[model samples]
Target: MKFAPSVGVKFHEDGSVRRFPGNTFICHVDPSLDLINELAWAQEQLKAMKCGFKFSYLPIESMHMTVFEGVCDQIRLAEKWTSNLALDVPLSETTDYFAKAVSNLGAHQGFEMVYDYVHNCQIGGSAIRIKPANEETKQALAHCREELRKATGISMPDFDDYHFHITLSYRVIELEEHEKAELKATTDRIAERISQSFGILKHRAVEFCTFDDMFEFKPMLTLA
Candidate 1:
């Protein structure tokens, strides 16, 4: 809480190892943003390199950013999934504290996320890295993490700073030497095209959602 937070205080650069939570609850990106088209450019690069490799490209509808993921309780979630019918309360105790933290934020502000780079060196393959451009956007997510830690008494496992990114595709097959060079060239061009463009989508809410569901995953709670 003492230091400034734009992306994450732990600031792990690409290729560095950082501890990840054992479990995660994610925050979905609003579907109507213009920035998603940037993925199209990134995908095209994958296509160019697909000559000797296999890849998995994400559909436009499935993009989302994880707010915070870790341990939480399910007593309320089981109830929400059955009793509320439409609304939900997450099972995560951290989510409960985070939901309350968002309410006390005093103002509702969405963040502007700028491209850090489009790299294919991730554990999952390729991704578009992002950084929060303004204080509100940075603090909004940072504050939520702070609140969850302070209020819930849960220790964070991802202690080293983290980078924020959207998965572009996963490499299903290994690449040959020439193919790797070609892919790198493609990535360079795609990165240039998006360097100055901000994502069209604005974060609408801090949502609590179930993992691995198609586009419209079951949202346990949405704080707008």
Candidate 2:
């Protein structure tokens, strides 16, 4: 459950989730170079197959490893939520401690790990899935999500029931007859080398962002 081939997010279902004002704010890590190169290569392959429009490739900078999304806005509600959810700690002091502890976890200590194995699989009706090396990465990611859930009271599906994908591109259309044939041919061509490895995730800071402001990773904390 920590990582599965699919999470059944049901993005196409009409009432799966509401379109709230602004975007879902979540903490995330900046996309690593491995991701960028993999995306660039994927885009190249997709274009070579003459199916560029079938999928929307993520611009390199837009890629991120989501920690958790759809949480309360950091600026407006973080203080209240953290205060109420702080485990065994005073409301006033818990938030500060939480920030530093997470920020400091990186390659130096070992928690800032790498996704060395990668592959492609279809997910949530989308074509061409890109995922991490294994479940260790997914488990680590889920641990982060669980901690955030504990502090914010944000709801999440069971960790075992979650789908962990690492790519930023998503298929925008269903394959037509010819498209399916070409896609299958293309998949076969890339099948041998589809697996890739992204390097260690050395996060500089966690960001809370809305859809309106997708270009910037707005820092949710003031380290100074």
Candidate 3:
């Protein structure tokens, strides 16, 4: 949508927030029509299921694949890292690699990186858990992570955990057991089909984002 420029927090040497940035890209996700379509489909399904859920579908503007967040200073370092990274890699590919690398890095390492790079910086977001996948899936994720490390000169800690969600929906209203089961079944089927389709596609990119709250996004950055 709209990209804004704003100053973020300034950090001290110890990685603490000197000040919070008033403007920042709080969420960064792929901005692709295909992803929009997928989300639209998922939303329709979610609505039709009518499991008494009160949460609204996240708008595209609010969704993002986070790069980093925190007090002003830490984010500056991450921004520098990202800018330097942009020089050596394509935006689409870099976004994909970041997602896949974090996923492949496992939960512990993934959490650490998120904490160190994004979370610790005061970037507000949730760290996902990797789901169980076959050997091929694991290998693919590992390869992506390795490539990111080599390119960024950032070594993630020992995190051998995986999560299978893309941080799509949240702030869910309470649901009954029956509703939960029904919704789970429907979402599971959708996830399975998506996983299969993505598995067949050798390369994919994280190019768009959606969010529960739109106002949180600030100082948006674009690749082109």
Model 2 TM-score relative to the real fold: 0.53
Worst ten-residue run, lDDT, model 2?
1-10
lDDT of 3 by residue, 83-198 (tens): 33444443444444444434433322111111011010012212222232456545645554455445434442332332333344432344556765776676676565454333
Question: How would you order the candidates by TM-score, starting with the best?
Answer: 1, 2, 3
Q: Counting only residues 3 or more apart in sequence or on different chains, how many pairs clash (N, Cα, C under 3 Å) in candidate 3?
A: 36
Better of 2 and 3 by lDDT: 2
Sorted on lDDT, best first, the list reads 1, 2, 3
Task: For candidate 1, report its TM-score.
Answer: 0.64
C-alpha-based local distance difference test score of model 2 = 0.44
Instruction: Tell me which residue pairs clash in candidate 2.
Output: 1-160, 117-133
Q: For model 1, give the 10-residue run with minimal summed lDDT.
A: 1-10
Tens-place lDDT per residue, model 2, 122-205, is 442222333434577556565666655554554544434644444534454455668767766765555445443444554443
Which wins on lDDT, candidate 1 or candidate 2?
1
Model 3: residues >4 Å from true position, as ranges? 1-27, 69-165, 199-216, 220-224
**Better lDDT candidate (1, 3):** 1
